[model samples]
Target chain A: MNNSKQGMTLIVKTVTRVTVWLIVLYGIYLILHGHLTPGGGFGGGVILALAFLNIMLAYGREATQKWLNLKFLEDIEAVSATLFLFMGLLGIALGGRFLINFLPKGSPHALLSAGNIPILNILIGVKVAMSLFLVVWVLAGLHEEKGGQS
Target chain B: MILPYYIAIPLLSAFLISLIAGKKDEWAVLLSTTAGASMLILSIYSLIAQNGETFVYKMGFWSLPIGIVLVQDGLTCLMLVLVSLISFTSLIYSVQYIRHMDRNWKYYALFMLLITGMNGVIITGDLFNLFVFMEIALFSAFALVAYGGHAEEYEAAFKYAVMGALSSALVLIGIAILYSATSTLTLAKIAEKVPTLDPGLIFWTGGLFLAGLGLKAAIMPFHAWLPDAHSSAPAPISSMLSGVLIKVLGIYTIIRLYFNVFNAPDFYMQVFLVLGAVSIILGGLLSIVQWDMKRLLAYSSISQVGYILVGLGIGTRLGILGAVFHLFSHAIFKSLLFYNAGAVEMALGTRDMRKMGSLARVLPITSATSLVGTLAISGIPPFNGFISKLIIIIALIKAGAPVYAILAVIGSILTLGAMMKMQRYGFRGETEIKKISEKIGWRMNTAMILLAVLCLLTGLMLLPGIRESIVDPVVKVLVDHSQYMQLVLGR
Candidate 1:
């Protein structure tokens, strides 16, 4: 019954709008508890990106661009990657070896037991989420660009 | 310590540039060049400070069976130095050269990743680690090839990616087979255990490597993608591809595995000889017919690499020395020539040699540098190419391979002819001056001049004192195959 020129029908949009927050929450859970479970940064990151992809498909690109610009996403990607690199460098400063695990390992099965691994997982998750978003969005929009390529 | 930085610095720069740099690309240029400069210094420092001593750095304090290791020996040092030097020049050249490409910071970012991959491949002592690093290098290379956003460029990049993916799969299979058979992923450990494996398994593993790495290296039969991919990239990138990338990804791994790990088996040596001779002659002949300036340079790279393979296939001390020296010299001269090609293309907006002429009047520096490059590639006297080629031919005669020596001379002649054709048509022609789309910038000129000077001076690497200190150590690594195992594994 939906007759919109852009974006999907009412049912698809409604389902996506309601489910987006839950998908993202699940992704955050995956990243935060990465050290304790099977799902880590990459697995969680793909799930997080899928949330955005769903939004893009349901609400159209122009609508998504209004709330989230590609440039901001890129900045997020860069910052997360830099932070990850900084963690590795900090390893050298603290332990005299590159990427050496200098942080204290807490008791087994605890949420924060694996020292810097959870921190790294969170960083990688954010970076991967941003990259997938950018790549997919750009490819989708590739056909619309005029001859500005030099 | 320095070995880690070789991988770390470039990866950090790539991330930082994307994070911090603005739309303008000035910071991108500054940061990349600084990174390149530091790497060059660090590589030189390691080479001199170690003075041929082997240094192995264990990752995260893990032992050989469990963790990755970075090993730096004479061969690694030579490659590290060569890579850093060419990359520094290419970065300088790209500062002004890539200005017209709209989003230039991304170019720098990808380029840094390419460097990181190459440095990783050079320093790593683990087998699977090498494959990982090779992928990093190849991925960036594919992106850079299609950077122009042209239809043909995309076509070329697609072809390269397909070939590269197939090669990677084959390499993975080879690594898997070796791992299953030997139960070790450390290269030195594999070398120690390989002699005891079933001969049939060894044959399959070696053949898989020969085919897989051979495709990456673009030997005689597997050379379809080199010309298109090399010619289609941005000029500085083309220089990087033809100059160091092929050697790093293809030739270096081949020699490292075949000689150091496989102990230069007789059958594989025969394959090297036949492929080397065929690529040399056929590549030279193909290059002579190319009307596109960069395309001809691409074909020429195949020929030059063929010479290196021939030297390696000869399987003697003098022959291996010739191979390493030629690899060194070829990196300098070929890059210089590609820079000249890039500069010419930048000015004219065309790569067709038929459309170029009288550039000597407008682009004096490019002309002068290109002449040096042409001479060096053609094996003329006083240039590094001549000495290296002479050594190879002499080694061939000494090794009692007179027929291959004859073919080598013919290949050299064909190279000379192709290079002269390039100079005559592209620089010295009487075609009236055409519209100049871009002016040759100072940075580009500086890069060309730097490489051109090195083309004449690198032959000094063979002098008595220098040879004792520099060249001998590298040759020693290849001559004594067990040295890699003993030095890296301490067995």
Candidate 2:
């Protein structure tokens, strides 16, 4: 877990880094396949969490916080919620129904199969990612506060 | 057509509140209050004239069997009114309740978000939409509960968040299973296709769905998070949480699934009847021993919800009628009680009954209003609770469930006992100001009094004509669950 290990320990660290990258990539792969396959925003988001977790575990909370500022994550979460709401509202304006699939229904088994489904997946991924990310950070911060209290 | 706005106003307000978080505190209050008030008015208007017209807004104008939709019917109208009314009252109460809190913008922002979620759940026609709205509402609620960040509050919020996350995950999995089976997401479409589903899928998914929604509803086994979250939140939020959140999230969702989607099967009713009975008796028994005032009210909500579930579960016209009536009555009076609790907590600086006495002398409006609310909820004669309780008991006997009737009567007495205890310890006894907490503003007093007046008057809505005009449509929606599809998507 330290930064200065060498030889076999360095090999172990390299393997861990590669494994974390694989997990993160796999999550995105699942998310992209959401509309046509069984995976979705939730699955992809969890995978992303694993990737982030690896980063934190490898470096430390401070390194992670530097790149993932709490304010930015909070904004992303809010914006994602707003985006989903707007997407639902857009269907209303389009004259079909609330949340109707107005986009071209790509071939059922194709990559872009369900109109809005892909959009929904992307939004869900971002929303879930930001939500989970911020929630984790907030929880960690709370722990620090609690530790201080005692 | 107008179904979307049930969620829109609160959501828009939340966005606006956040955008203007630091600019002007007064503007944030005005904006959220206006959003809440507008929703309140719209819901009441919908309640009165919402019959015979089913509004369906298909997402993106997509054809049937494929698109997500928002369905607004009589039942939706009832819940919409209940949610907005309670939300409005709570927002009003919070204007003064949360003055001491530093982050006013974040508080109102979350409040708006919670309202949006609750409102959306009542109106959405898509199963997936239901889950989405459920997450939005519960997530914001978790944040609000932790707003105070006191050790106890944080502990409760964390517990609540963990349990809430589990339920949401279950619900998402259930929706995925449902989607896999039906290949469609609209609620009416699901209702149409669900009956023909394979029995294994029906049983398993149904159980999953039930467990998921049941946890949200806090019925018996899934109720572990209720006491802590309910007791630890700010008083206005405590009012909203106990008064309306559980009903919208748990009871309403369960009823919608049972009646519209699942056809009110015997097993579901049986489950509801038993849960209702147990919650009523158990919650009542637990409340009697609680010395903390808001905690007592929190427990009382579980018992009250039991009454609603039992009434709705009876499946008779009288049963449905009694259930919806009790729902409206509870939303009003319970909120009134919370406002009273908030007022006392403000003036007396304590939620423990042992620390308060003869409070009526100093806080006349709060005491008088609380007295009215206590009488109403305890089923005293001429109050709203009595009428609904009577309807439920009569319906129970008519449905050949005589034992439940007896138990309900006993529950009523227990409720009466608890309220009497609140009355004696909280207001009627010698005024004991062991410690001064803080000064309460006029805005707080006005909100409590307004709700108390409504409690006293809403009972008159039980008159036959008023019942015919107001309650019948909502009852009919529950009774005629199978026709919801036809109504929403005309044949």
Candidate 3:
């Protein structure tokens, strides 16, 4: 209990929250601009998870549950993974081969370029985002349950 | 054509099961087991059909050197069959084994995910894609290993996660470097580009991939996280992790990358030879000191992997054949042994070998299966392990590596010693028998017996027709490295 005395100040909290939100928004921006720039789904998704992690740590698990529930996270993961697979399979069925860049290529170096690459990036971004969150949550839960029986 | 199904079936079932598994928890075992059986059959069929042929399922007809592809060659099919076989048995065993556990849906879901990752890793024709699949497998595995959430499991999972992530980062860097060098991600395309690339980049990328994947495989120098992770997981998971996960994630990918993607170097072979020798000796010596049954098995996996590396490192055709055979044999026997350990723990409520014994009097089936596993792993005559070990030793001697050959023999003896200790403490020691409430179920026994039977039959893989049908094509893929690129790219 004595350790609680070194808690964050209001200004610090507000600034931290703002920074975290910005980081999250920037991750989304990067993901959206994946096919255009160097950053793609993996980079953006990892940043998004960092934002989620910040939120989770700032608010307790119980408080966070109201907004970012485990079930919802799991659903997001499953759905996104399925969507990615479906997109790949669609390419296959269309005689393009699996994960082929079948969709029309937008202008190169544009936000919409690389045909289905951007869409794939988004799908992968969702999958990675949720997956990282789930992994962190699971790890955090494990840490909390340190005293329990195996 | 068969390449897609390897990834598709597992991916499909993982989703399907996750969707319905919550309500159908009781039947999840059956469903997963059925999937495992069908995948096993499919893998075998793929192997038989694709002998001497490389079947590539292009992601979107995006053309070679660009798009992702699922390529099935003889070796990939062999690894697939081994993975599927072990998965089927573990799924059956898990039915009874996980009866008292909570979160059954999550367990089955993660199990399905793990299988998908493994299947994807085996069939993937791209290097970066291999790393992705490896992550999928490792991520699910970390959660599964810590599924119990007990102190020891958590500690073990944390350690495993850190090590796994480090290895993954290294792998990602390796992929980046390889891409930078070759300007291609596809294995076939990279193989085509290897000679055209700068030698300096090849040297660096090769070292990165080796360090990264060697850690995953739990080869000697990089094998810190394995024992804790393998020993802490639930019994069936322990079985899967030791039996197939390390082989697929670490060993198979390393071989595929080395022989197919990059040209095998004399120095690389020499490095593997040295590491293999150390792992063989160290793993065996360490296992001899462990008191925990599963921990000992985990260490034994290191030793067995050492033997496999030795076989491959020898680089002779016989050496490669031996390594491939050992991979298959080790998967069967190790999984069977783990299943036996699980049964013992289930019945006795403890895994410490020091606790009670002469359990053979009570658990005849487990005792018998374990004996078969122990003997097979110890390289006793007439078993699958003997054939592979013999081939590896002969290959070592033939390759003018007598020192390694001698070390391999010592490793075999050490394995025998450790198994003997296991038998003495777990089976031969007398223990008080309380009235057993529940009968040792059929699912458990069936799984162990099936694996035991495979351990017995795997020796026949050396037979001429069998070798030609099953083993030779796999060996051919590794030996005829240049042909692999042509076959896959159809250039």
Residue-level lDDT of model 3, residues B234-302, one tens digit each, is 989999999999999999988988877777877788888989999999999999999999999999999
Model 2 residue B190 CA deviation in Å: 2.5
Each candidate's fnat, listed in order, reads 0.66, 0.47, 0.59
Best by lDDT: 1
Q: For residues B419-456, what per-residue lDDT tens digits would candidate 2 score against the true structure?
A: 88999998887765544466667778777888888877
Worst-scoring 10-residue span by lDDT in model 2 chain B: B431-440
Best by DockQ: 1
Candidate 3 chain A TM is 0.85
lDDT of 3 by residue, A1-150 (tens): 112223244555466667988998999998999877779899999999888887667655655666666887777788888788888777777754666567788677777678888888888898898889888777677655546432
Clashing pairs in 1: none
* Rank list by lDDT: 1, 3, 2
lDDT of 3: 0.85
Tell how far residue A55 is off in model 3, in angstroms.
8.8
User: Would candidate 1 be rated incorrect, acceptable, medium or high by CAPRI criteria?
Assistant: medium
Deviation in Å, model 3, residue B289 alpha carbon: 2.1
Better candidate by lDDT, 1 or 3: 1
Give the docking tier of candidate 3.
acceptable
Question: Which 10 successive residues of model 1 chain A have the least lDDT summed?
Answer: A141-150
